[model samples]
Target: MTSIVSLPIVIPLATAAGMLLVRRNILLQRVIGVVGSAALLAAAIKLLYVCYTEGIQVLQLGTWPAPFGISLVCDVFSGIMLVLAGIMSLTTSLYAVADIERRRTAFGFYSLLHILMMGICGAFLTGDLFNLYVWFEVMLIASFVLIALGGEKPQMEGAIKYVALNLIASMILVAAVGLVYGLTGSLNMADVAVHLRDVRQEGVVLGIAILFMAAFGIKAAVFPVFFWLPASYHTPPAAISAVFAGLLTKVGVYALIRTFTLIFTENPQLTHAALVVIAAATMLSGVLGAAVQMDFRRVLSFHIISQIGYMVLGLALFTPLAIAGAVFYILHHIIVKANLFFVSGVVHRLRGTYDLKKLGGLYATHVWLGVLFMIPAMSLAGIPPLSGFWAKLAIIRSGLEIEAYWVVGVALFVGLLTLYSMTKIWAEAFWKEPASPGPIGYASTSGLGWMVVPIVLLAAITVAIGLGAEPAFEVATKAGQELVNPQIYIDAVLGGRQ
Candidate 1:
């Protein structure tokens, strides 16, 4: 049972080792990759069940105590994130196996994908700040390789900017960690929270918070720091891009939530005000940018920034319901956003280009594809009877309760803008008639069951979550409570913090 804490890392590390051994055996490599991802998914589910039945679990590596040894803590928040990461990795692995053209590099790709997942899981589960930094580096290196895998010109270009910006962010993150360690004499998050309660340094704490925010802001694709995302995200293959889009930014947001809720809770009045302003600007700018985009993938990429604002907005509200809504929104966005990108991959495979001008009237020829795309897109746009609507309702309800009229107004406005942008894609791609009818000129591939399977599965999950909101909301509420009350997590890690 103690070893279960490491299953997330173990599965991926083992898969990477196996891939290296069977580099020449393509079928074996694929099988190993899928098996590894499936195993991780199972582990995540089991972990969630453990959280529900037995409460929070903490594992200290090597049996050493906290503030001395590495610790992994699983609260409801970490459990939910684990589950979401597993689902995305599993589905994306399936898509990559079938859709990727470079077979020789496929093993390497899966290895990197698993490595990224390992880092994400580690980051979420770990209770130490410095350990989280190490995981971020792991995630970054793997992402660099994944983005640049094809050696294409655009991918290379995007990878360069991505790596450069992320490297700088990493450095800033480390410097912030050093400052926090210097101030608190500890690298463990639980320890830092306890220390901060006694020591007071207004300027230093705010400065460290700002540094941390800047580093995570770049990673989260917030407002001014978001240009790199739109520029780089569309360059990768859809499978790669979908997973990156779905998971990477959310990790940054997760860090923000964890850090603020635990360590920085001392001054929410100041932090919340700043976060609310940032959230509003991020929402407006992202949607406005999406409205002008001509490429389908690019449009969705910009909307990622906009939708992230909603999640951050929930955090800014600083209420239980709002926080729960943010948690639920993150889960919803991961599935819907990834599925949309996969649908774009299918459309690109069928129609030859991602430009809206070049794509039209797919509804007539490919009704299934149209329907598949519509479900997630409409859900994203906050149409009723979908998962997106519930998330929005929760956030807005919280905002109104807190008398955050401005934030609520911006959220409503962003929701409408989201609808408009999605409708633009629908009008251009599916509804409008294309210039030519039979056999669009892209890479016409026949058995695309692997690609379609994941998309359909995610789409179904999206609808299921929408219809089954009660249970999902319960999980999210539990996660939110755990986040707000960090003592349970701290105690689990440090043998009961004071």
Candidate 2:
């Protein structure tokens, strides 16, 4: 099981090194990228199955005991994330085959993609704060390179803001880790949780908690700190944007959920209450901002911030069902959001523009494309019989259960606004006739089969999860149960050592 837990990180890191060596052969690079990501998907599925049946899997490096050695731990929550990382990695890698130019591909794009996935896997699996920071740095380096791969003017501009804000986040995260170590005398999260139980520095602990929140809030792109997301997300190639949309900020959200539930439980009233306010603000601001954007990708980017609020709201509500909904939402949003970006890329390939006013008649020209776009778009808007519908229901129902009517009202209104934004895209991009007379700007679909495959597969998953949600819901419920009860994780990480 420990070996299985390590496979998600190990597979990608190895593939990245392999890809770097074969960087000149574009054919080989694509093969390696696709095959490697596919292999990772298999490994992640295996890990999920193993963890589900056998419980949390842990690996202590160099055979060192808990709290002394680096540990890789995979519980139900981490398992779910690992599975998501695998699916997105494969899909984005496939999209990159067609979307990325050969010049960019030759310059180590495949390598960087694997490295980014490795970092995400490591972040999900690490059992200690120090390594978590290390994984964050790894992700930052890979993502910075990937975003700035082609050196386009907009890419560089976006990269600057992205890197600058993230560096600040890294500094704060490092500072928080140092504070936690100084206060608890442990870098291992489970061990720190145990020590904090006996520590008497309540005020200091609370302050450190706030520091963590701010640092991760920036990474998660919540509320006022989220400007960097829309500024940068639309700058990269759609494949890059899709992967980032799917995985990056969610890593921060995952960290927040893990730490708050496992290690920072003492100040729920202070911390969680603050999270509730932040969540509502993030949702309203994101959706409202999206409602006004005319560019295809930019609108999707802003909505990322809005949908993040729903997941955060789940964590903020801090109920078993709310947390479960948050988990389900993570899965649903990753698929739908990434697919939407992929669809944007496909539209750009066909129409040569992302401007809504300049683009139209997709439905008439490419009916299949229109259908693909709507599956995820409608799901994202939380329409019935789609994955997003269930995900939203979980969070809203949990809010209802707790009788937090104000946030619930805010959430429901935001859903309506999200639908409005989706409708705007539908009307402008697909519904209306093309701006020009006949055959305005359709590109050849030659060699685009790979790109279309992933979009269709992801859209199918969105529908399947909606119609057959019980299994996913059960997994989410079990995951939320583990999150709400920290003893399972603590014991897995530090059974009798402490």
Candidate 3:
């Protein structure tokens, strides 16, 4: 079980090293990237299965025990996150084969991508606050390089903004961790949770909690802090944007969920109330931002912020069903969002511009492509009998259960705006006739198999999850139960010592 827990991070790190060693051979590097990511995906599924059947799995490094050693903990929440990472990594690696240019490939793109995956996995698995900080730095470095790989003016600009905010986020995280250690005399998350119960410095504790929230909030891109995302995400290549859209901010959300649930519950009235406000503001602002954007990728980028609001809204509600809604939202959003971005890339390939004014007739020419785009797009908009519908329904239902009527109203209004945005994309990109139409000349389909397959697979998964909501919701509900009761996690890390 421990071996399974370790494999998610280890395989990617090892594969990245292999990719570097064979840097001269671009073909070999691509092979390793795809094969290695697939292997990691398999391992992630296995880890999820083990956790589902055997409970939380923990690996203490070097045979050391408990608070004395580094711990990799896998509960249902982490397990589901790992599986999502695997799916994204595998699909993105496949997409990059056709989507990333050869110059970028030769410049170690595969290595950096795998490194980013390793960091994501480590961040999800680590049971120590300090280690999570380390993983954040690792992810920061890898993503910085990947985003800046092309050295285009916009890529560099975006990378600068991305790194600048993230570096501040890192510093804040370190300070928060330092505060936690000083107060609790521990860096282990479970240990900190136990020790915090005995700590009497309520003022300092809540202060530290706020600092942590600010730090992760920047990473999560909620509300006022989200300017960095829309400013930068659209500047990158579609493959990079897809991965960033799917995983990066969600990592911050995962951190917020973990820490708030496990260690920062000293003042729920103050803490959770703050989250509720942030979530509502984030949703309204993001959807409204997307509503006005004319650029294809830019609109989708802002929508990411809006969708993130839904995920965090579940957390703010702080009930089991609400958290389950959050868990389900994470699963649904990562797939639907990434698929939409990939579909954007496909559109870019056909039309050569992300500007809505320059693009159209996709549905008329390649009807299958339009159908593919609609699956995830409609799912994202919360259309019924689709994955996003179930996710949005779960959160809205939980809100009703708790009588959070105002937030529920805000959520429904956001959904309507989301539908408008999706319709705009559909009208401009797919339904409207191309102003200047012919072949819509671009790359040949021969090279696009790698690109198209992943989009289709993800879209199918979206529909399957919607149609098969029972098991998926069960998994999310169970994961939510684990989060609502953090003892399942703390006990796993401490080996019953707590």
Find the 10 residues in a row with the least total lDDT in model 1: 98-107
Global CA lDDT of candidate 2, please? 0.94
Better of 1 and 3 by lDDT: 3
Task: Give me the runs in candidate 1 sitting further than 4 Å from their true place.
Answer: 103-107, 438-441
Summed over model 1, clashes come to 0
lDDT of 3 by residue, 1-498 (tens): 477789999999999999999999989999999999999999999999898889999999888897998999999899999999999999999999999989999999999999999999999999999999999999999999998988999999998999999999999999999989989889999999989988988999999999999999999999889999999988888999999999999999999999999998778899999999999999999999999999999999999999999999999999999999999999999999999999999888877788887788888888998999999999999998999999999999999998989999999999999999999999998899788875344645556788999999999999999999999999999899999898778888887686
State the lDDT at 32 in candidate 2.
96
Instruction: List TM-score per model, in order.
Output: 0.98, 0.99, 0.98
lDDT of 2 by residue, 200-308 (tens): 9899999999999999999999988999999999999899999999999999999999999999999899999999999999999999999889999999999999999
Which 10 consecutive positions of candidate 2 have the poorest summed lDDT? Answer: 437-446
Full candidate order by TM-score, most accurate first: 2, 3, 1
Clashing pairs in 3: none
**How many Å off is the CA of 372 in candidate 3?**
0.4
Clashes of 3: 0
lDDT of each: 0.89, 0.94, 0.93
